[model samples]
Target: MPSPFRHTTPPEPASAAGPVRAVYTQLARDFGITRAPTFVVLSSVPEIMASAWALMRESLIAGDGGRTGKELAALGVSEANRCPFCVDAHKMLLHATGDHALAERVARGEQPADEDQARVLAWGRATRIPGAPELTPYPFPAAHAPAYIGTALAFHFINRVVSALLTERLLPGNVQRFRAVRSLGGRSLSRTVRRHPAPGAGLTLLDGAGLALLDHAGPGPDWARATTVGPAYAALRAAAGEGERLLDADDRILVRETLGAWDGAHPPLAWDGLPGRDRPGARLALLAALAPYRITEEDVAAWRTPDRTDAALVRLVAYGAFAAVDRIESALPVRTAKEAS
Candidate 1:
């Protein structure tokens, strides 16, 4: 099959080695998909790919939160970000959860009939807002907050990555658009969705191996402290930090300041304060952080050159997305249960 990647060459899953291979292996065994484009796009940075997979696998796939609820949260985030690809993928995953009615309802842009799911969906979407009051009383159980919170945060990053790096179609020929295809695709992975993966199974790809080499990998945010989510979060943070080298120090500061002042509302069509063509990388970064869907072909074209490779674009966008994630994480209330001792 042709790779879903547009701007860069995706790693050959067949010949991938070490941590990259481990991530592919786990995705097949645990995520039930052999070639996940969202992840393969990061294979240029094996540690980042492994770290990102760990966060998603631990929280969305194996963590303690309800699977259907996590899917709702993920879908909510995708909706908020306007990532059509992720939105489609999540609706299919929702079908995998066997809530076809709910999936169809959400796909139709309708609120779920169930009050709890409605709240969960709302909470997931609302997470994009920094310090929004709705965030205070989390919709899921406090004890299960790590999984729920991790799932939301993970998608916050993943959605940005997808919108900026990948094309809009989740599958070839846009096959996922058909209701039957969506259900069938979801059904294909129902076993993986229902099976309980060993908690922290993704760590096998990150730990003790040279994969954990990021210097700034800290214990993660207070909201995600005391769980497997922390290390995974930290590794991703450190990995994304690699983008700092792509832009001038001043451009990085500009992107951070822009994201810090953001209100989670989409910017006006004009998107003021963005740099001009002279600073295409920064422009792309800021867009990735706050309004990835707004990014255009010209925008990417402006930054990409013979000198800048696909891996660099991925890093630059990851940096921008994580800047926004940092802002979101900073404002996140401690709604989850206190860290385990």
Candidate 2:
């Protein structure tokens, strides 16, 4: 049967020599690197890889929890892409995030050092395979499946973006390596060859554990420090309590303003900050409060330009804050005994 993936045959070395040599020549001409080889024979994965870096950096600015989430997702994608460069980069990022053991496992492609890492890696691998079902046998809770699917889709989107850039040889450093990997000549295989009994069952359990970690860690210090804006959170809570939907422009403006203030004052939050922070609970609270507003790539892009200020940063903060709100509401049971009482 024909493959569903966009498989590109590796050009013959002689055929590749022209383009490979041309890329080096262009790099030399463009960058004026006369002495060293203009194009290092790295794989054609850098543009997407660079984008991943930018995305992660932006996510970090958005909030600590957001950074952690994006790091895991990036690791999953790197592993799926089978790009050693990305794998190495994510390992460093994970290490920086304080997950050394799991980072090592992901780098080596061995069984994850722990269940959390395994779930992420498995999810990443699954995203790379065509026609894989959204639901897996992994131990993830049924209720959390949508979130897992969201994670998977996020990775898928990143993978597609990276693959497009790499396949097109847009990244000079990766051109040679991409050509080499393609030339090594493996079948364009997908991971869905056989169904493992109880495959993905581990994910349900893993996701639960991840959620537990998030809960325990709270929004984390980064958010806690920024969201010292107590009045804003109070207003947000009151609005939410009154069922004043976020669609109202006034509500959005309030959320946007509060978050903007938070972002401006606080340092960019990172994954590593979570375990060492004093008030994970407060941080989590702030994040939980902010998770609900709809965010898009455009919103993220707005924060990326070099000239952004504290107020702009606050927009990102607001995005994270609302996101936190969404997460809290989604994860916790709504009809509690207190409410019923």
lDDT of 1 by residue, 1-341 (tens): 66577667876788888888888889999999977999989888887788889989988998887899999999998899899999999999999988899989998889999999999999898899987777767787887888888898899999998887888999898899999999999999998888887787776667755675434577776666677787778888888878879999899889888888888887788867888878998998998898887778788788888978877888888888888887887777874456433
Per-residue lDDT of candidate 2, residues 147-258 (tens digit): 3333333333333223321232322444323323322211111111111122222222212322121122222221122221212222222222222231245444544444
Cα-based lDDT for every prediction: 0.85, 0.33
Model 1: how far residue 187 lies from native, Å: 0.7
Q: Model 1: clashing residue pairs?
A: none
Candidate 1 accuracy as TM-score: 0.94
TM-score list, all predictions: 0.94, 0.30
lDDT of 1 at 152: 89
